[model samples]
Target: MSDFTQRFLFDDFDARGELVTLEGSYRHVLAKHPYPEPVAQLLGELLGAAALLIGTVKFDGLLVLQARSTGAVPLLMVECSSAGELRGIARYHAEQIGDAQSLGELMPNGDLAITIDPANGQRYQGIVALDGANLADCLSTYFATSEQLPTRFWLFADGQRACGLLLQQLPVDRQKDPEARAASWEHVVTLADTLTAEELLSLDSETLLYRLYHEEAVRLFEPRALQFRCSCSRERSARALVSLGREDADQLLAEQGGTVVIDCQFCNQRYPFDAADIAQLFAGGGVEPASDTRH
Candidate 1:
């Protein structure tokens, strides 16, 4: 019911913030996959984090956050486009996932990788070894080493819900003293770090800010809407089949009743393409094949 995202700016400080409450979006993501409890919780948090990260970006791009593990949860990936659409999926061993408590326990020696692809420019990537016990710290490392920006994050996800808060420092005017900018950024991060997961997901923007920054003059911005959306289609699937080469595609088509069945791992949407679909793909060229976005 209360499924929306809000972006707020601190009026008197050189700082901005974002808060996301996920209900319908979270449910829609989970409905497609029967993930284990631990994996599900991690996916929810990653999904929220991805949305928060993408919303702040100015250009039309895709923002991806991934957790790679050598343990039960081999890999967890979440993607958010510039339009505020999101999709995610996880891979894990069910037996190993049993009785797992924390994300660290499930993803030992894990790391976080973030990639940004602008619509008209080249993509960029940053990676950091998993150093903290939770997603927040992992992301903290990213901000410190990758962007060098003073940033803070609060992430929380139970078996049912997921939410996050982000605060970042903004550049100051040339006439403004450098010390003033540093101090403002430091103060914002300190207050933001004091936020708890319960407070982040449960309280409204006004109440949460009052609790954290009661002493500072804070300005809140209009909220943004975030939801679950899958970018999948029949033509996309057919193009993918064409990439498999004609011989392989025909053999598979012969074995499977002349149809290729493709399912979207992110949303579980199924696309069925018969021989005729394959013929059209090769005949009418120019449609690019669906490439893997996870790399």
Candidate 2:
């Protein structure tokens, strides 16, 4: 499949891994706005990492990867849901972002945030300083420090598509001996380190797996499909308007020249409401406002 995530288990290494290859979803996010190459690639890698992170957890809500800075790029965010919906956006200053390639350069003094908001449980978040050379290094450090797990991530993106592969050493393993388990982990991680961005981005999932670990026994699970689906709707935007109450809504409406407009940053979809529509929405009988507008 073109856009999917696959989970696998290592028979001998006692470790598990995840691979995600994104095309349609990545292109759809890019189509929403004009992004420079560095910003676009950064968003893609975040999308890949978000997808892999979703697969690693058992949650019914959303997982977000975000980095905000006062430097060149103000905001870089990507999110994926339990149902495999993916969306991302990046806001950057073109003049300040010239020729800067590293994450540190793109976002100085930035904080990388991984947020897990579950539908029925309390939300959890991990924050780290974005001082690494690349996004992958930052994520690897995050996992090492936070989860205390030996997780290695390989993320890549071209203007066309984005891809990511994650190799994690499962906490509980078949190898009982400590030294042998460490050795196994090292062997698998060492082989995984040989993976290049080209091979990870171009090759198919099974082909790439075989090429990387043809000698090892690996079990590939069913792939989960992912798509670019925006959660914005007229109804939801109307509820937001409801919260503004009548007076504020009227003032905002006047400022907006008649209709109140709310734009979805992820998909750039517009939801507009006029006077009558706002009155109906506040009257407890919601009315159809207007069709969505995309720029």
Candidate 3:
């Protein structure tokens, strides 16, 4: 009812659109870290984009949006699961964050990667230069350069709530005439481009869609609910300890006062690995049968 993604079809044209709004989930991700205003807003945009991806891409597993850079913001990542779970994080250099406004300014020379890890199929990845004026334009550039669909994204976030609208041109379907398809696509995107960030962040899916495409034939589909859920768990943490090998695990356990704490950066959930737990993990016991402890 609150955090949701909806897909709509332009009944008269060969195009479709995705709408996503986030409030509770966005706040949850923001609460996990002391992210600066810019970083938080950027992360919110990524989260919105990730949810929109879920609506547009028919995948059964996980989809990740990552932008890596060596500038003020070293990393910005968002994960969306088919089951409607979402999580995101951002790492930034404190000294350089105050003046950076745009994505390029915050993460100069960054590469945006879209990774699809299906539950049963091969993983797919697409990388593009993050050089557009905004996140939406950046994604629009990616879709345009990749020769996929003619897709344009309108992403907005104010560190409190995040929302986005994505309009993509599909292959010749209902509107068989190439010229008609082009005209329809142009009309839809032009109307969408008239949208403001405030309107996007404030309006509901139905109102916004009507405001933009009221004259066009559009069918709004039922929205899929989304929530903030970290994939980290005690078992996953134990596996990380096992990867360190016995000697290193033991050394870490000693360094952390007999308990090696592995914190989930996305959610700040802590997993403590004591000596016995580490021993059992390294002894091939599998996850070390014990109660879970997290903060």
Q: lDDT-based ranking, best first?
A: 3, 2, 1
TM for every model, in the order presented, reads 0.89, 0.96, 0.95
- Give candidates' CA RMSD values in order: 4.8, 2.3, 1.8
For all candidates, what are the clash counts?
2, 0, 0
Task: Identify the runs in model 2 with alpha carbons over 4 angstroms from their true place.
Answer: 290-295
**Of the candidates shown, which would achieve the greatest lDDT relative to the real structure?**
3
User: Taking the tens digit of each residue's C-alpha lDDT, what string does model 1 give over 49-148?
Assistant: 8888887678897898888989999899998888888888889899897788687789998888899989899898888887587787788777877766
The residue-level lDDT of candidate 3 at 153 comes to: 96
Error of 3 at 286 (Å): 3.8
Model 3 pairs whose backbones collide: none
Across 229-259, the per-residue lDDT of candidate 3 in tens digits comes to 9999998888888888888888888888988
Q: For model 1, what is the alpha-carbon lDDT of residue 137?
A: 78
